[model samples]
Target: MITIIKNKTLKTLALCCALGVNFALSGCGAGDSVQAQSNPSTLATKDLSAFVNTFWYVPQAYTLAYSYSSSTNPKTTAVSDQTIWHFTSANGGYLLGCSFTSTNNGASWTSATIVGSVTANNTVSLGFFGGLVTVGSGILTSSSGQPAFLMQMSSGIASTGLTHWAYMLPITSSDPSWSSLPATNNVSVPTATASGC
Candidate 1:
């Protein structure tokens, strides 16, 4: 009877240890499943409409590029000047404005505003000089790895149109490069009634 009792006690101990191990392993698996569900595998598409009623700084060194033709300099010149891209929500689409810092003198900025139609892909068709001359199209895309706004614009006549600018703007001020472009002047969004989305 002593031997039988000893054997039964050992079996019970073994069973309890096995159950504890299984529970621990199952708990670990559950934690991993929850973590996987929280992190999405794909990123969502960002559009220009997401930036309505916002102003973004554009650093000339990394963000501004343009081509122009003139009597003295016919080639396109890439300038590093501070600028601000401001947007506003309108009836049909968004009104976009570009305000540039005065290079000739340290004075207030002069803004040129236009109405644009934004697409789901973040493509914008903004008129140049109030639609008198065509400025071409521009696009806004988000960086996959970083929380930044990427802008790409093309300008000039259709026959000689060139990629005007490609710039990166940080979405949050927490980013280290957020202050790279400082806003010195106030930019205002124009009231427009352009027919576009």
Candidate 2:
């Protein structure tokens, strides 16, 4: 009788251990499932404008070869010039503008008209882990007959606010000087003469 009681007790303890192991394995699987569901790639689609608004433009100098026509003809002329960039606030609801200056043949045009308060819409798509910025459709017109549609791919870190952007413009008839300005490190406010519109 004593031997039978001991055997029953040992069997009951073994059964409880097996049950505990099963519960532990199932709990681990559930935790993995939760992690997979929380992946950033599965997040809802975000508006491009929302991403653009989060960054204010940091001024930099660029050397650009610009032309006015869509044709890559041998006759197309390229100019080296500079421009200043101004970006919108954190809602992508405003027009970010560039003030460009050009010197050609001893003649200088200062503050040449860039896009006038043109608002960018859903033009950006964020990448997984915020490693890239994909620009959708950007439409801006120059004072001359040059109309620009820009699509850019940029890479940067969100924590440092550093990014590199590349853009392509369809050919038109105006060849503008492309240059980069010295660091102004100043925020630009719209002047009254250009403000009433």
Candidate 3:
């Protein structure tokens, strides 16, 4: 379920809604951070707003939330302690509906209609997991092995190569985070004013 807040503005706001979720972890405080195991792009700094134009077709669910800023401020300077994410898939597995939007920068996001039921896995690349002022995941992780969230991007812990259909780990009732899964939109991409790609 996508939990929407009431502080919608522009780029950052929408990103927050899509990528905001304070896992309320115990061992890892808010200050704790994680890095992408491998980055595909040459960019030293990953600009998330770049995804505004470049959307991942069917993401298992966007994990690894982090904050990012470029050229001063992308659009506004509303720092978010939590990061919300947007994941998508063609097959109607988890989020069978179309992608969502937040006119007020995530004050509230509206869900779109579902178009299909053929699920597929998305690409798991470093480009998919880079750039962020901060970082966290819904998946309870350990120092070893890829975060469970990475599975959404590909097959197993070592998923690579081209993109394909794959299922996401089910968020059980025991988990302690506001998590949501797969959804996508190729044509209705949003334009972001933020410049941190």
RMSD of each: 17.8, 19.4, 21.0
lDDT of 3: 0.27
Best by TM-score: 1
Q: How well does model 2 score by local distance difference test? A: 0.30
Weakest 10 consecutive residues of candidate 2 by summed lDDT: 28-37
Candidate 3, superposed: residue stretches over 4 Å from native: 1-74, 79-107, 113-170, 178-197
Best by lDDT: 1
lDDT of each prediction vs. the true structure?
0.43, 0.30, 0.27
Residues 58-98, model 3: lDDT tens digits: 13243222223343444223321112233333222232223
Model 2: per-residue lDDT, tens digit, 10-105? 565454345553232223221121111233453243223532322122123333434333344543345443223332333323333333233242
Candidates arranged by lDDT, highest first: 1, 2, 3
Q: Residue 185 in candidate 1 has what lDDT? A: 30
Error of 1 at 120 (Å): 2.0
Q: What TM value does model 1 have?
A: 0.45
